[model samples]
Target: MSYGLDAHTIKSLKKAQKNEITEHYIYLKLSSFKKNRQNSQILQQIAQDELYHHNALKKFTGTDIKPNIFKIYFYTFISVIFGITFGIKLMERGERNSEKLYGELGQKIEEFKKIANEEDRHEKELVGIIEEERLQFVGSMVLGLNDALVELTGTLAGLTFALKNTRLIALSGLITGIAASLSMSASEYLSARTEQDSSRALKSSIYTGVTYIITVVFLVLPYLLFSNYVLSLAVTIIVAIIIILVFNFYISVAKDLSFGQRFFEMAGISLGVAVISFIIGYLVRLFLGVDI
Candidate 1:
């Protein structure tokens, strides 16, 4: 019962069918590994819905479609590395374009409309129920990442002009970054201990410290690789921007945030501080009569 669907419509329906089936398997795999009973049940329900949608489409198309194996592994790996909430939300974000397509097809087919509505309403509600520890400590991670970006970018910029040596700048940035990360972690642990358990507080601090150190490594890599301080400074700034872009994008998708505002605010502050610090470094070098 293709319902007299045109060739193009059949092709579109087949694509949608494939997506539903693939997602079904992905959700099934995720549910199987989930330790939380409630989360596992919710994921299984969503998977069942996806399978239902696939079967509905199969009735119309009169064909069977295999799930996308690569997508199955890719999303599962992402869910394992990143939190399940983030990974699933990211995958669902990609489905927005497909939702639009579903809307268009719904105008002609009643079944498409039902599928679109269920996808929009039910799956979202189910996905919202999933909770992960990493997401709960996102604030700690953000604090660490933001501080590292702003402080280290400025510190590196200032040192680049003042020291005039890439190796020296790298060594100075590494020392400063490590010290700051430790300080930030301790502060986070203390703060979290006021409101949460000792174990949770420890985890929060670890997240903050690890994020800060990783960011520090990325920003300092250019200085270690390049000979000229100015060139290394430029590359570090680029790396900083890229980090801001990626992190904000991940947050925006996972948390349903406005990406542009958070991104510009962060990047502006980091770079602005770097500029001011650069001037201060030059002034100090001139006035203090210090040579490196």
Candidate 2:
């Protein structure tokens, strides 16, 4: 049976069909990366569902659409590095963006409504079943990353004026960051041990330590590369802002939270600390008669 789809409707349908096929490939590719048998099976089932959706849409469009290969590998690589839950949740957000259009199309053809509902079900089921190891240690990551950002940003800002040399600032920041990362990891391990399994506690500590170290590297890179102290300080702060933006975006999508509020709140706190620290550094330098 052929439905009367006008040019505009056909174009829309084709776009959706392309999305379906692309997602089908993405899910199919990501399913292989899951180590947990149950999670793997669930991903496989979702992939098959996507394939079914693609075939159904193809019937309407009358032209077989090729999947977007770039998206397939891109999402696959993301899943490999960021954990399957993050990648899948990000994809779910994409599906949700088109929900209203699907509803509109449904008014013309009932099949779209069914597809939309199925997509909703997929998202809900995914949220419930996803058990990635990385997600389990999110609290640890938050602890490490947040502490590093706040502490290091303040420390670097203070040092920027007090030390007033790019090389010296970078060295000081590295020493401080490394020491803090170890301390934070140890504290996390002890804290987690009190509440959970030893293995998980160890994993939490590792996550915290790794996250802190990575943040430190990025934040300190500007100081290492630039000769001008003021320029290095400016670049370091900008890098801190970027890190906050990217991290908050990942968490917002995976956890389904408000990105703007979290982003602004975090950015404000880090910059505020830096500003206050900068002032204190200047006052201390003036009072102590430090010449470097």
Candidate 3:
């Protein structure tokens, strides 16, 4: 059954074989963490498919290959924190990138092409059937997260310039953040109720509120830890950028959106507002002769 592949083709097959094995391990581990019977079953099915691919490729190399231990743990951890859909989609992006390699190999070997087609078919089927709760309420989470980022970042930046005391700025920011979170949640609840059912509205508000509070806590942590106002402000801005980066990456993976564009837009707007607020605060402080 020798297809008489060249050295380069053989090497490529081995690399792909390793990737398949790695995904098999990752899917198996992720399935264990899922409480939902359907999701667990789907993951198990994917794992088996990956194992089959690994074995088929093993015939070419005439040797067994070990899975990547690092990737398995890394993606498993990502699934635990970010939800199953996000982790799976992120992994799928890797697989998509390898499609060109598959096509190249397929041109040389018919078996490789057949396998690539079958895998693509399976991917489409799996994607259509997947359902995750977190993804379902993503809009609500986005509303909360974006509002918190824009509003709190601007407010804190203004306070940082207006008040020189770290403790005082942090205290003021905390109080304002809590109050804004509650107001945002209530507004979201009302808006959702107007558009959807009461139950969904309530759930949406909860997601929004929880997300907002979490964002606020992260944004204010630097001020609480650092005594220097300028240093705290710098850390807080960095934290805000990181939050934007992480959230945009997750959304881009799960929803098939543009990561760079969304990330830069969100980050730019937040930071731009902060800069404007800082200037405004500085002018107000100077005009009022406030020395705090």
Candidate 4:
């Protein structure tokens, strides 16, 4: 069944076919990891749909295509580490160009339109129903992460100027960070207890504490590694911004939020507090006449 397609069109169709087959395998692999019967069934359905799309494209190209093995393994590893919802959503976002191509091709071919519509409607509905514990406690993670970024960044910046010694700054920041993380965890536990059961609340507090400590370790590492206090502080702020960028991007993709807005807002608040703390540190050092 020759559609009288040009070489270029056929090539593009083959690429799309490969993508569909790759995702079919990816979804199939991911479904096996799901313990929830409903979630597993949903993934299985999506995998079948992807397979159907691959065969549909193959008809136009009149050729066999291999699935991308690297993509299948990469997304599977990501889903295992980060949770299935995030990994799947990340993969779907990467397919936006393919979806656009389908839309363009749909104008010329009726079959492409049907495939495009199914991709847009059915798969999304299936993915939306997937439940994961990490996502359920995302708010706890955010609370811990945000507080650590703002409070610890400001504290470290203040210590950097006040101490003017890398070792001293790191020591002070570590103590402060550890103490703050414990306090935040306890507070979160109490707060969550009011809204949910004790077991879930405990889990929430653990997530909060672990996330806070992780952020603290990253922020303080620069001071430990670098001798120059100024450079250490500079690196710490850069690290803080990077943390914000990465976390916001994850949240944006997994939760379908606006990346730019959340990223800028969090970055602005954290850096602004750090700057204020730095000035305060200088003023306090000047008034106290401390020499280290």
Choose the strongest candidate by lDDT. 4
Candidate 2: where is the Cα deviation over 4 Å? none
Per-residue lDDT of 119 in model 4:
83
| Model 1 root mean square deviation, Cα atoms | 1.8
Give the lDDT of residue 44 in candidate 1.
Answer: 92
Ranking by lDDT: 4, 1, 3, 2
Tens digit of lDDT per residue, candidate 2, span 39-138? Answer: 8788889888888888888888888999888878877887787778888887776775467677877787788888878888898898998886777777
Predicted structure with the largest TM-score when compared to the true one: 4
| Root-mean-square deviation (CA) per prediction | 1.8, 1.6, 1.6, 1.4
TM-score of every model versus the real structure: 0.93, 0.95, 0.94, 0.96
Across residues 134-233, which tens digit of lDDT does each residue of candidate 1 receive?
7788899899999999999999999988999999999999999999999999999999999999999999999999999999999999999999899999
Q: Which ten residues in a row have the lowest lDDT in candidate 4?
A: 121-130
> What's the residue-level lDDT of 231 in candidate 2?
96
What does candidate 2 score on TM? 0.95
CA deviation > 4 Å runs, candidate 3: none
Better of 3 and 4 by lDDT: 4
C-alpha lDDT of candidate 3 relative to the true structure: 0.88
